[model samples]
Target chain A: MTSTPMTARRIRNGLKIPLMLAPALGLVVVLFGGGILVGLGQSLGYFPAIGLNEFTFSNYTTVLTDRNFLISLWLTFRIAAVTTVLSSVLAIAFTLVLREKFAGSKITTFLFQVPLPVPHLVAASGIILLITQSGLIARIATAVGLMDTPADFPALVFDKGGVAIILTFLWKEVPFVGLVILAILQSVGPQYEEQARTLGANARQRFRHVLLPLIMPGVMSTSIIIFAFTFANYEIPLLLGVRFPSTLPVVAFREYQDPDLALRPQAMAISIVLAVVAILLLIAYRRLARSAVK
Target chain B: MTAVSLRHISRRFGDHVAVRDLNLDIESGEMVAFLGPSGCGKTTTLRMITGLIEPSSGDILFDGESVLSTPTERRGAVMVFQKHLLFPTMNVAQNVGFGLKMARVSREETAERVKEILELVDLPGLEDRKAHELSGGQQQRVALARALIVRPKVLLLDEPLANLDANLRITMRHLIRSIQKEMGITAIFVTHDQEEAVMLADRVALMFDGVLQQVGAPDEFFRTPRTTGVARFFRNGNFLRGHRRGSTIHTDVGPIEIVSTSETVEDGPSVLTVRPEEVRLVNEETDQENVVPAVVTSLIYMGSHTQLTVTIGDTPWQIQAPAAFQARNGDTVRLLLPRGHVSIVADDDTATTGSAEATLAEGSAVL
Candidate 1:
């Protein structure tokens, strides 16, 4: 009763990180948890603000079965997958080439990283201006006699294929992923490569067996972040997307802005589905990252 | 058995030359050590031999054939780096079998050879452990096994044991020497540690400032050094400034007759060097031919031997005697410099500085 129990309780209390993080964690739980709960309730058709207070799965059923929503979901998945794979491949290639300390390497590295600080919205606009029909390339092509008119140029932006969105994501994400991989490569250094060469490994063999395995974890983690970010991004897709089959976030926004207040639950339903997909992706990413470390 | 020959090899980075016009022939199955202090170009020479760095001029030949245009993987020479650069992602067995896999060896034979090499390095049953899970010494053994599994014709070791503790360093020195002998590979060991070089190599090549200072057997190096630099490097004895007159050299200390064995000794501005163990302490008032009267300045009691600093005509001289020899500070003693122990080295202009004198003082203090 003297001092032992007080000291013991204090030491035991020190082990609770959640208790220590109550201030910030509590705010996150309230804001994010409350927002997610509201969305789930609305997605389940329980929004009392519009006087619909019944707990039903009809909204989810409707959204899941819609042909337009299905197409939008497929487009989102395709864009995320293709963008993640292509950007990561290009990033790893650029990182390997720029790892060496050659003349003007400092300037070259600076140039490579220049796009990182730029906003995705700005990069999307830049891509549209350069490659969109009736944009800079079309004008230049017509002036060079390669095209008769701006309409003769191929459709690169505001198309169902999402080519401009993919290009914008690549422009922004490749350097970000490349910088991360470059950091890991620099930390591991050239010693292992040299050792592998001395052990009779050729150039390709060294890259495959030595450098690739060493940088896999960094590459995977960065790719996961890029995938999640691009999948959830609303700005790039909204700025350079067609009207027929839009990305999930764009469709969710359009439903939320509909004049019929009764359709708000449909917007929340789409939002909930997108969040679920992102969470599933996050779980998969964590599993892949843990295995890569091993 | 392959002899490695470096013919007039020189390496320069910009205006700074790392190794200058070095010509060395390493006999087949011989383990030669490149011994020098840091920044003395030993590692550069080793890397050049391993084909990691090409020479700025001249060429390297393996078994009398030029390997100048050969790639590093095809050079048939492997190097153990200073730091243990074991593959972090692979376990011990996988790391050791990497080179074998590169050569497309069968999995069964690779596993068998990996096990055999792990046992040879005394790291048996550790094949499943990752590099970070093992200790420094164990990681080094894995690196050694990895390099040796390739069956390279020449082995280049760059300060392989420098990261280990003193006891482990000694143990690994014997392990490397025995393994090299057992494999019968021509080896080049580059190290800044003189003791390690002398303990392991068949011959030690001492270097300084991009040049080979001396190369000989360990015992020959200690008994007879060719220059003042080598004498100072070995910390053999007191180097006193002297001038030759006939068979005797006149110095601050009394003139001691010397027998000139070097053809380059020409009777002007020579330095006399004698080992501390060679200087004999005799009874006072003895008038020997090469004996001089001195007073003991200090005595250091080492475990097996006692070191004495004695002064004769204001110049300090060091002498090593048995621990039982009794002498106190300020005691009068007679010292003899035998003609065989007194080596007259060519007086280099670089060795006559206050900093050099300070280094000699520090060296004698350690002795």
Candidate 2:
């Protein structure tokens, strides 16, 4: 006798597709949807377990009027913007130089990809150690008679300008952009470039007309992602950042670590603001991408 | 003495020789195809002609002036690639105007020329459509328009129809031939498809193993191929090992009559190549003098004609017959190998054994 019933068989076949998709759906809900809900509830100051159960706008107001909020936000935007622009230009140059066949192309490509696998914190520390006043650069300067002492090294690291932080981001981020754009460049297929040459486009014209537009999507998307990552990053800025108002993520971390439990919602509200900025940037990027494709 | 001439052209990629001591002269207003397999230096030859590649040692002259030293941009030659290379960001009109713009042509003239070229390509209103938005054939038309708008001295096409579907390819072949003929511009077409070369080119330059096997009219190359490689590349040709006795070459099929210019070498072992269409099928009892007995192993009906695989003395020869011909599998028939036009070349025992075995086992192999 068959142990499987007709109804059960029909039900099993009907549930097969949903069963296969269960893991992905569960991941989206638990990770993304759940995080958003938790952030929203905490931002509103309505968490019951911690005994703060009131509907108020104080968290948002505090986050907005905080002493370092505006400066940190501006600082973060400036650093991210500079890093994206500089890295995108450098990545495009690097890709063009390495696109053709040469003796060192493979080694150059390998070296560019090496930074991508390195942890961001590790890279940050490496940059700090190399560029700090008491670090190897200053030591070399002093030894080479360029400076009288290591303490006389210029105050680039941990300055109000955030030059050191931007440099650190560029050092680690440019290679990622290069690798992504390199793959895009390779997939573009050289037929178009050859046709352009035949159509009387010189090297510059070919780059502007054929190769650049084809690779623009990869460049823009990678640039936006890098901008968001550098802007929201906490550890690198916290370690190598100046004593004054740090980035938004650093400010949020300080609030989160404070002993007073009531300030946790304020930090969560700041995080929610950062998340909104990121989502807005993403939406703008998608719109730009659609326009470019058309 | 010619519109395009390559004298003793040679290209070496590191240690490997791509094209060695190649010499060719194409007349003005002639459409010639550099026909060969993938790596046989046909593309390298075209690239040299278009000034995209520099020959290792040679002088390439167009209209009695050396273009070998000229850069690609100043050579006054435009190339249409196998894949449509229309600018993705620009509409068809902008792409067609790109070359004129590069030459610093005025905006009014560029616009007028772009319109004229779009009309020439039969794509008048398609000027506003982006390259990707157009169909494959339409994109190819744009590519052609973009190249021809420059009004170059010559047009070089690198397998321009290789990317299209079968029907589109056939249609484009006729279109390109008509356009090339109409424009009276020196055209160089590169392709590995023999049929395409035969259909499009006024003269076909058959290349094999990085050397020019023969350069002649399509009928000459088809009827009197200078080498076994050329005959093999053309179609389903039956090649039989033979021995030369005076002016005749005796083979398994029969003795083939031939003429040779080189009389210094004594021919002991040779090969005879005959195309399938030259192989006639007659009644088994008809005792034609040049006929060989064979049995039909398979019959394939291909719209215009029927292709028969007939086995004769352990070797299967392809015989093309009319579509309405009465023929079926397992029918005994007598096959005739043409004696007068059959090609005979000295067989290099080492080189051909491998390629012949490989070519024999290719899709139409018979047991």
Candidate 3:
């Protein structure tokens, strides 16, 4: 019974974070949370300014039941999954090579990190200029006599496969994953690898049993952020994806920008749905990541 | 069992020679200690045996075959590091069984061997604990078990007991020696402390400035050290400059009689020393063959013994006397330098002391 009242020191410890967070959290709550509240209110069909004062479930039902919703969801999921798997795998492989110093290793590490600071928009633009049918690679092929003309080059950009979108995301996110894991590898030092060598683990076995399990935690956590970003990011998919089956963010964004304001609730519903999916993904990734080493 | 040998092997890091002309043969199933001060190439020699660091010159042989071209994993010369570098992400059983798994042993066999080795190291039923969860001593046992599971041809230890506290270090030393003997595995341990070297090794190889100064049984080092450098390293402080004639060394003061336990030197100019612990105090009424008249200049009353500094014919000598003895500064006493404890060592870097003394003699002649 006496433990019910916290001691002064305990009370001080409890208030430490909130007191520290109070200053920066004020503007963030108003600008970020305020917008989410407005979006939620509208998604529930309670936009009084639009002459819809009654709270209802019609907007959610409409967004859920729409036939193209599934296609948009599939496109978003495919792009995010493919980009994440490829980039995470490539980052780990490249980081392993970088960790073992060789000729030109420093230069290779410097070039691998060159894409890290470039924004997603810039990456998307670069991929467009270099990979589109009449873009730089196509012209180079034509000039090199591999193709008769630039138009003869295969259709790469604006394809139904969403290759351009995945490429752009990979370009931006692979370096992020690599940088995080590389920093982790540096902190871990070289003695563990030397110890493994002395234990008679060959190169492949060392990587599989020792190095992989050690660096898995860093890779998995960074890859979660990569998945979320690639899933809901708007610009890369908007510029690279086809119009009919674009990622969910682009579709929701398109609906939000429509001149007819009644579609606002549908757009807000899609936004809420996207947030819910991201949360589910966060939970799913943590579960998988925790068991990966074992 | 593997008879590991290094033949004229040397390692250089850029221009600095880490190990120069290191030649040693470790017999199969025998344990040898590589003893040296820090930076004396002992660790470098151990790493070379594991093939972790390539020797810049010469060859390393296992069972009389050159293993210079073999990679570390295939060499079967496993090493236990000072930090006991167990894999951080692995549990105890996983870490211990990793080597067996690499050899493509079945899961059941690996498990059985891991269990056996863990019990041997006295950490039973700790299979599921993570590496970080173990205490420092427990981690070292896991490391030893991990190396032993593979049945390495030669086991190398690079100061593995260096990180432990005093009590734990003694326990680990006994555990290591028993395990090595039980497995009949050839082993080499590198350490800077002479006591540990003498305690653990069947034969101790002393190194100095990237060279093996001497190699012998621990007792032989105390009885018959080869050179002044070796004698000075063992703290043999009472060097008498004399001419050798049988067991007698005629110094400036008088002919001091000694009985060397190992070898008799050729009749020539000699420099001899005895262990400080072998020197004893006697009264004026006693007469002895090796007795030399001395005066106590200083004394320090350590708990176990009183350390006394005495001078005989202008040369200071250190002696460890019984702690309860009544001796004071300026007391004239007769000290006995016992037979079978004094050794005649060869002249090397410390022979310059004789030349410096000759210059003093020359100055006295000029005066």
What fraction of the correct interface contacts does each predicted structure contain?
0.91, 0.73, 0.86
lDDT per residue, candidate 2, A131-190, as tens digits? 899999999999999999999998878889988888888889899899888898787777
Q: Write the per-residue lDDT of candidate 2 for residues B1-367, one digit (tens) a residue.
A: 1399889999999998899889988999999999999999999988888888899998999988898777887788899887777777788888889898878899999999989888887888777887789999988888898888898788999999988899988888887888788889899989999889998998999887678889999988777776666776777456666566777766666766665546554655666767888778777577556676777898888879888887876776787887877766887887766666566654434365777645543422231
Predictions' DockQ, in order: 0.87, 0.52, 0.75
**Which has the higher lDDT value, candidate number 2 or candidate number 3?**
3
The Cα error of candidate 3 at residue B165, in Å, is: 1.2
lDDT of 1 by residue, A134-228 (tens): 79999999999999998899998999899999999999999999999989988888999999999999999999999999888888888888889
Best-to-worst TM-score order:
1, 3, 2
lDDT string for model 3 (A5-111, tens) is 66766898999999999989998999999999999999999998979999999999998998899789888988998988899999998898888789999999999
Shift in Å, residue B365, candidate 1: 33
lDDT (C-alpha) at residue A90 in model 3 = 94
Q: How good is model 1 by TM-score?
A: 0.94
Q: Among these predicted structures, which one has the highest TM-score?
A: 1
Model 1 chain A is weakest, by summed lDDT over 10 consecutive residues, at A285-294
lDDT of 3 by residue, B73-154 (tens): 9999999999998888889999999889889999999999899999999999999999999999999999999999999999
Q: Which segments of model 1 are wrong by more than 4 Å?
A: A1-3, A6-12, A285-294, B245-247, B259-264, B312-315, B324-332, B350-367
